[model samples]
Target: MPLRVSRTPTIRHYVMTAPTFFSVEYAINPWMDPTTPVDTHRALDQWDALRRTYKELGHTVELVEPVAGLPDMVYAANGGVLVNGKAVVARFAHPQRAAESDAYAEWMSRHGYPPVRTEHVNEGQGDFLAAGRILLGGHGFRTDIRAHREIARAVGMPVVSLRLVDPRFYHLDTALTVLDDSTVAYYPPAFDAPSCHRLREVFPDALEVADADAHVLGLNAVSDGYHVVLPAAATGFAAQLRAAGFRPVGVDLSELLKGGGSVKCCTLEVHS
Candidate 1:
């Protein structure tokens, strides 16, 4: 099926109380440090600032109530991938996050997004990233490679499977950020040889982020064609975005970084 293209402005939806229960309850990825103490208040402040930044950019914002005991719930992008107002609910791999699927379904149903439930293990936007009409899917951690087929069936778009070699860049969003309909910025070393070659072939002119910037979760960013929202710490990546003709808006979410998520992790793009 041809991808849905509309003239309406893109809306960046987010969960308001994401950090209300945010903390490192378990060690899932390399970014997760159980020993690092989390400050709930700091997390809340940072998240709020990110929301405001989105609004300031003239994008509509939506919220899902944070459910208690679901600390990872704050990483809202993992809930599902929204396409043309329909949602493909994610099936989390960890038992600790299994309950999140239902919460996301309820939110989608309540907000007029019909949900497509899939049994294949996936982590929503964490592994599923859309670039124009193509869906780039990640495997080797968090999500199962078979889930790409289910997502392709659900969204009716070609899903490209990319194997992540490094655990630090476990999710596709961590390794790449879709800057625009035809452009992307990625960390080449994060993917396996075949996957890296595939990405280079697909996006031949794609920007390559430096290792220092990737280490700070720079590629885990949100872009709305013209404006790219990212972590303030990623100075090098920010410069690259500007050079690519995008306005880079940086916000500090170091508190949520404790849970191995960044700006894109806290935001979800809802298509109309």
Candidate 2:
């Protein structure tokens, strides 16, 4: 049976940063290997395709100017968590991505979303995801657990903390994605026992992905209630999404995947 669509498809607003300075120079996550070569042009093309996909889906796309040294800035989802016309800018744990906070904050402020910087190390939407009336926060890698409290206070929403145990799924967006207000798709092995239990309890009908799909960052997808944009390499996930009544649009982000990010990583949803 198909999963029930609880609400009409929402026209989302997304923010993206170009891959002009994209490269695999530093080894921050398990997916990044500095020894491998990166194709800047190909990365740009892939990102543009993703942007176009969002526009074609009737969603708005906003661009953030990319900085020369911050290659990971192209993963704009890490910039901040925007909700109700307010943004909680990321306080990146690594020095390499620390400067990106200011840029994102400035953009948010200029665009009418008041920005707040967190005292605890939080990687914004990278570790925080908005689902329904609450926020799902990930920790044990890039973001601190305490940041969840700060986020809850700032966004005025309840936050459920989920601990990520797998090094490869360092970010929540990489291991899991909210398909709609009441549904999600995730890899169980990526989270701890308690976190896994919490996920199952909260999202009983959530799609459980196989290891093959998880390896390809299949869960790093973006959805606007009806259409889901995911990695083209994750064919299995595409099939599962279709079975669940979602229109899956696959895009090749092979080049951007070289930097440990894909559709959801490159696109940050601005909830207002």
Candidate 3:
């Protein structure tokens, strides 16, 4: 039998692109060790596997054209977060990825999505995730705290700010994943004391992932309420998801992990 996503009342759409120009040429996060070389060929193969996984589970997948010299462009989630047919483009903190803003903007414009250029620096869904009525955002690294307010105003949702403590968990999507409208999974160590407390207050029953899984970018996974797409190496977390009654489909994205990205990093939800 083919694995299927347990559909919610509303459908969700995601955008991703093949890793045609992925490489770890610069160091942005702790996960990126420039000394370690990345195999672009293997990265593409893994990315294709993930894309196929999404399609197999019954989800619409859109692609953003890959351009030369933009290695990080393959991490589509950083482009921007889409909500209500509007996209708030990311003003990247690093010069290396600054060019990606326009590339994502062109795609949105062509697709009838009006782009709202954010004033503060934010890395799209990489730092922002929409869960039900609220938006969860992260800062203390690539994204500025001020960007959270900008995102809230642009998207017209109440935004909750979670401060990331660990450099390896620089992005919110890296340390935390929204499993459903009410449930979430997170690596507690990635957040500070207060942020952890806040997460507990908001999601008291949030699933906690072990460090063994977190280290492999397991928390940086994608979920459509029922089906979860994550790194194949995160066996512990995969078993946990299955136990929670959600279908966990593992995809090997080890090559992209050289650049500090996994499944969620390459996926961007396009809300209608």
By lDDT, the best candidate is 2
Root-mean-square deviation of candidate 3: 3.3
Residue 195, candidate 3: C-alpha displacement in angstroms: 1.1
Q: Which parts of model 3 are misplaced by more than 4 Å?
A: 1-10
Q: Mind sharing the TM-score for model 3? A: 0.95
Question: Which digits, one per residue and each the tens of the lDDT, describe model 3 over residues 1-272?
Answer: 54643545334688886778887889988888878988999999999998888888788899999988899998999999898666888899999999999999988899988789888899999999888788899998989999889889887888999999899899999999999988899999999999999999999768999999999999999998888899999999999888777888889999998899999999988976
Candidate 2: where are CA atoms >4 Å away?
1-7
Better of 1 and 2 by lDDT: 2
Query: What TM-score does structure 1 among the candidates reach?
Result: 0.94
| TM-score preference between candidates 2 and 3, better one | 2
Error of 2 at 151 (Å): 0.6
Q: In angstroms, give how far residue 143 of model 2 lies from its true place.
A: 0.5
The 10 consecutive residues of candidate 3 with the worst lDDT sum are 2-11
**Local distance difference test scores for all models:** 0.86, 0.92, 0.88
Give the winner by TM-score: 1 or 2.
Answer: 2
* Tens digits of lDDT, candidate 2, 207-231: 9999999999999999988899999
In model 3, the Cα lDDT at residue 8 comes to 53
**lDDT preference between candidates 2 and 3, better one:** 2
Q: Write the per-residue lDDT of candidate 1 for residues 1-272, one digit (tens) a residue.
A: 53433212355554433678898988888888878899999999999999999889888887888889999998888999887556898899889888988988888898888789887898998998888888899999989988889889988889989999999998899989988767789999999899889888999879999999999999989988877889999999999877766788999999999899999898877755
lDDT of 3 at 47: 92
lDDT for 71 (candidate 1) = 91
